[model samples]
Target: MTDASGRIALLRATIVVVAAGGLRALTYRAVAAEAGVSHGLVRHHFGTRDQLVAEAMEFAIDESLRGSNMLEQGLTASEFAAGIESLADRESALQSFQYELLLESRRRPELTPLAERHYGAYREAIERQLGRLGVADPALVDLIWFALDGLVFTQLVAPADPAPALARIRSLVESAAA
Candidate 1:
């Protein structure tokens, strides 16, 4: 594999390892095995475990935002988070990896910045969406974000059909603009 692709593969492998077995399960050997590469390659790419975990977290956050259409502009409230279910289903491991990292930050103080960045991305995206819909209040945006956050968290932890709840959220969002 090329250098860039190989590195991203390692990042993805890191996500899967953490998702399946949490942070403790992550090691150069584990990521190497998951990526089908040598442990030395994993080390060469990331240099340290902290770097590996941080890069993986950032990658997952970007990918999750892109896939969920959360950062895309011009979407109405009904259109916001339209493909969330599919994104969640397809990228459950990625989602779990992020949650693992977020929770891990509680124990490992060094991870706080990345954890904050992760949430900040979601908040900014929500702000943009709400802004387009003429809902400019930060407090209202935060409330909506919390509700949406809880919705996704519940779906991930419990595995449920989220269509009804999602539809309700969209309805509320649309009416909130009126």
Candidate 2:
């Protein structure tokens, strides 16, 4: 493989390992095994486990955000909910890995800033959406975001059909708009 392709393969492998095993459980050998590369190659690319975790976390967040297309114009609550549901269906481990890193950040101060920055992007997107809907308060953004987060978490843990819950959330948001 070319250098770029090799790097891409390693990065993909890193994401799978971290998503499947969490940051604490990640190992160079595991990443190599997932990537079909050597452990030395994994270490050469990432240097350390922390670097690997940071890159993988960032990649996961970027990929999820990209898949959601949340910044597109004329977004609706139902559409947003559908995006969430699609994420749950397609990349369940993405959310779990993100939450795992977030919780783990509480114990690792160095990770706090990265987690906050990643989460801030989601918050900012929601805030923009709420703002477009004529809701200006930051608190309301927080509330709406928390509601969405709760839905995602519950879906992850309990594995339920999210349509009804998402509909209820859309109703509540719409009612609040009135």
Best-performing candidate as measured by lDDT = 1
**Candidate 2 Cα misplacement greater than 4 A, ranges:** 2-5, 74-86, 173-178
What is the TM-score of candidate 1? 0.92
What's the CA RMSD for each of the models?
Answer: 1.7, 2.5
Candidate 2 lDDT score at position 15: 69
10-82: candidate 2 lDDT, tens digit per residue: 7777767766777766788988899898899988887988887787787777777776756666866555544
**Model 1 ranges with Cα > 4 A deviation:** 81-87
Clash pairs of candidate 1? none
The best candidate in terms of TM-score: 1
